[model samples]
Target: MGTADGDGLREFYSAQQPRLVGVVSLLTGSRAEAEDIVQEAFVRLVPRWGKVSRYDAPEAWVRLVAVRLAANRHRDRSRLTGLFHRLPREQAAPDPAEAYGGDLEQALAGLPMPTRQVVVLYYVCDLSVAQVADTLGIAEGTVKSRLARGREALGAALRSDDHA
Candidate 1:
């Protein structure tokens, strides 16, 4: 790529990286994992920057990649869990509620990954249902259903927390 192309990619990365990390973190429920996922997405984007930069919303490409990576990682982790015994680590991890430090974040974390992805992409990213469906490669109807379920679940969780 030319110097101008490199400069444009750098500027895009600077502007979009933090926001993408936040979106991925909400999707993955771990800031550390989100960082890694987002970074890898950008790495993958490097070669495609020439083409992707011309797109109306290049960030969407990166976000889609990061989301898919997070989903793949979750699936791999689940499969590995079936094959191996998990050993207790020496370090005690912080409670997710405390780590996230917000009732909404805790509630989102409680959601099933699929529901959480739809909720985060639609609400947090402010993407339209069609956009979300496109990003996730699902039907718009599926996105709508997931959003409905997510809203109900989040509402109940927040209500219960309020009562406690």
Candidate 2:
């Protein structure tokens, strides 16, 4: 890659690192593993800078890649659980503040995959319904429906937490 391409990649990674880490962290509870996933996502992007550059939504691609990799990490952990004698640290979820703090974050993490994906893209990332639809390769109406359902679920979860 030329210096210009290298700079562009650096800029892309720099701008996206925190959001990618946050997404991965939600999927995989380990802050450490989340960082690793973000690194690997960027590594996956390096070779395809040409294609990525042409992509109308490179961030969407990165988000999807991170989600898939996180899912794979979960699957790999489950598969190796029987093979390993020791318990995995990633399997041990972090402690959250039971009273007030981290409640919303915990709730979001507990949601089903589709709801979580829609919620994260629409609420957390502030992506529009159409943008999310494009990212997930779904219809705009589907995005709207999912967004409504996710919002309702999240709202209920939050309300319950509040009343607790």
- Give one digit per residue, the lDDT tens place, for model 2 in 27-91: 66667998998888888989998789778878878888887777677678656654553557666
The model with the greatest TM-score is 1
Model 1 C-alpha lDDT per residue in residues 1-164, reported as the tens digit of each score? 99999999999999999999999888877899999999999999999999999999999999999999998997896677545444454444434445433378778887878899999999999999999999999999999999999999999988888887
- For each candidate in turn, the TM-score is 0.86, 0.73
Q: In model 2, where do residues sit more than 4 Å from their true spots? A: 27-30, 74-102
Candidate 1 lDDT (Cα, 0 to 1): 0.88
**Alpha carbon lDDT of each predicted model:** 0.88, 0.76
C-alpha lDDT (0 to 100) for residue 4 of candidate 2: 93
